[model samples]
Structure formats: structure tokens, C-alpha cells
Target: MGDSVTSRALALLGAFDGENRSLCLTELARRAGIPLATAHRLVGELHRWGALAREPGGDYVIGRRIWQLGLLAPVQSGLTQAASPFLHDLYGTTLATVHLAVRDGLEVLYVERLAGHVSVPVVSRVGSRLPMHATGVGKVLLAYAPEEVRLEVLQNLTRITAYTVTQPARLLDQLRRVRAEGYATTGEEMSLGACSVAVPVRNGETVVAALGMVVPDLRRQLPRLVSALQVAAHGISRTLAGPASVEWK
Candidate 1:
């Protein structure tokens, strides 16, 4: 079998990533491993279809249409809608840096966040992807992730800070504890002076996402934080459960 026109087009698009967001024709061809003429033809087609846009400097970037389509994705629209109220409540209750995240392969993808003016400075943002071993929400997602994904992350643990878990054996133990305790916590693992705690958000039996909060410290307030997060997570879960949600009133 040979690469089809569709595959070639997709390869050109796939050549762009979190770092290489913009590329000239030559760079696109080189990265996509296609000939210059073929790249130019496919790029023109994608540009006409609103999949790629050319900047003033003549570099191609993802177009506005892609952003519009991404918003229509169920993971973005449905989850955000169901969790918005609970996220607001959690932020009001804790006045901390609140986050909503889901697993994307071996990384954690933050979908929503709310932060108070005085909350700890965190490095994450909506749509940002972070290492699974360096974040509380990531740990929660990793703890319950598929076995293949778990092993992949364990084998590739990278140190993000002095406190980040670099040892796969230790990280395996921590994941076990997260499963046992129903939550995960990290102290300055992603960044200095930031500590976090997280719990799983469920859509029925499957864990769909993780809810978390970043604080200056968790030593004196872990218990209260965990309780509040669980409450909000429960609310979000019920919202996602739709008409079949259990009645707790």
C-alpha cells in the first residue's frame, strides 16, 4: 500500500505541533517528508478549505475554522458545559487555583481553570498539556488510566522540578496510593511554591476527567481541600450523568 492523497495532506497537517505552530512551505515539506511540489499543492488545497492560513510572513498556521470546529467537539462542549457550574462553585468555596482536566494519551490536558487573585502562581492554562508525573490532576488521571498508558508514562517520567517524581518505581507506588485514597496530591512537583490536590470526575462508571486545585501549600489544609474538591467533583459527575444520576437530595 502507498500513501494516499488524504494521507499526504494529513501528514502535512500533522507536521505542526505544540512547538512548531507555523511553517513555511519548505519547512512543511521537509517535516511532512513530502516533495516540495506535492506539499505546495496540498497546502494550497488545505488553505482553500480553511484548514490552514498564511500569515503576512508567508508561514502557514492553523486557521480559525479549526478552532471553531474544535469547540464543537463533544469533549470540549459537553464536558465544559456540565462542569462549568461546579467549577465556579469550587473556585468560590476555595479561592484557590481550580482546574478541570482530562487525559490525552500520556499527558494531562487542562480544559478549564479558575484562579483567585492571591492563589499560587501555576504554569498551566486552558488547553495546555503537562507531564503526568508533575501535576495532581495528571496523577489522578494516570492512576486510573489504561495499563498501556500507565506503563508508557512510568517509563518516560521527566523531572519538571526538584520535587517531581523521576523514579518510575516511586511513581508506581504513588499511583497505587492515589487509587487507594480516591485522590492525588503533589507538593511543588510542577513548580516551586505550588502544591496541589485532585480527585477523579466520573461519568457513571468511567472516570472522564479530573478536578483539582493548586495552593501555596497543602500541609495544613489537605483535608478541607479534599472534601471541597470531592463535593464539587460529585456535582460535576451528576451533571454529566444526565437523567440517570442518583438522587442524593
Candidate 2:
């Protein structure tokens, strides 16, 4: 099948990932599946427009302009801005690591986080992508995700830890529970010694994001953590539904 110039250009940019952040021209061409001449010409254009930059060692890296442009995306900008206060309040209240995330394709895309002074160590960061079946936020998002997205994720489940749920049927059951209970919880699913609880943040009838907290253990603070997260999620949903408002009270 023939790809359009736009699709090829996008493929070139999309070839780069968290692990493949930098590539030389030939490597970029091969990875992008574009002819070397076409890649060279298109990459030159992208470099000139600041979508990509040439490193001192001649590798191509994503440019600062791309990051600046990504920050302008409504999901990144408006949602992060609206959710900041609630995340801060949650962090202050529990001193647990608070996370805000949205579904990006079949993955949970971390958009914002507020770390507590003495919270448990977490591996996720803003802009990082985690599996949709292995995290509290991921479960919430998957519970409400489109059927095709859920199926795709179900087929490609990767176990990050021994506690991570890899069975499709089990994950589907958990997703149903997440929807029914209005929250999701995971114990050492994504990382050791880190447990998380998450609730959905809605924009009217649409579940636009997830609000979560990571703690060392859920044995003692599970109830309180869920309560606080639900409250913050409600506030965030209200803000997302109406005009921009930071009053998360």
C-alpha cells in the first residue's frame, strides 16, 4: 500500500519512542520504512521547522519545539491546569504520591503528578506510558475505554511484576468491578512496594481521566485514600465540565 507524504512524515516522527529517542539518518529511514532519499528530504524539512534537531554526534532527536507544542495540547494543558489544585490538596492531605492520567490509545498516559514528601517511590513520570491492565489509573481508564481499545490491550498484556494481571478474563472482571465500584486498586502490580488506588474523573458523562494515589501499602489507609481521591476526582470533573476553574473546594 502506498502511504501519502503526510502519513510518511508522521511515520518518521512516530518511529521515535521512549527507548528509541535518538537515531541516525539511515536508522531513522529504516525504522520509518521510508526510502533513504525521501527520509533525508523530509527530515531536513522537519529539522528546519524545529520538529526534530540534529545532535552534535549527528543523531536526530525530538526538538524542544515539539515538547513546547505538546504542552499546548488541550488534554495536556487544560486538564493538567484544572487538576493541579486537587492533586496538590490530595498530596497535602495524605502525603501520598498523587497521579493524574488519561488513556492514550491502549496505554495509560501520565499527565501530572504531585509527590508527597515521604511517599513511596514510584516509577511513573509525567509523559510516561504504562500498561492499561497493571495500574490503578490504567484499570479505571480501561474500564471506560472503547471496546476495541480494551480488546487490543487485552490481547497484548505484558506482565511488569509478579502481581501484574496478565489474564484477559481476570482483567476484564477487574474492569467490571472498577466500573461498578467507581474505583480501582492495585497491589504491587506495576512496581514492588507500591500500591495504588484510583477513581475516575469525568466530564459530564465522559470519563476523561483518572485520579490516583500511590502508597507503600493499602492495608491501613485504603479507605481514607479512596475517599480523598473520590473527592478530588469530583472536583476535577466539575472543572472539566464547565468553564476553567481552579477552585477545587
- Model 1, range 25-58, lDDT digits (tens) per residue? 9999999899999999999999999999999999
Q: Which residue runs does candidate 2 get wrong by more than 4 Å?
A: 116-121, 146-158, 167-169, 244-249
Q: In model 2, how large is the Cα lDDT of residue 69?
A: 96
Please, what are the lDDT tens digits per residue for candidate 2 over residues 1-249? Answer: 358999888999998988899999999999989999999999999999999998899999999999999988987778998898888889888888899999998889999988855668698888899888999999999999999999999998888999999999999999999999999999999999999999999988999999988988998978888999999999888877776554446
**Model 1 regions lying over 4 Å from their true place:** 116-119, 244-249
Q: What C-alpha lDDT does candidate 1 achieve relative to the native structure?
A: 0.91
Clashes of each: 0, 0
Top candidate when judged by lDDT against the true structure: 1
lDDT of each: 0.91, 0.90
RMSD of each: 3.8, 3.3
Per-candidate TM-scores read 0.86, 0.84
Candidate 1 has what TM-score?
0.86
> Measured by TM-score, how close is model 2 to the native structure?
0.84
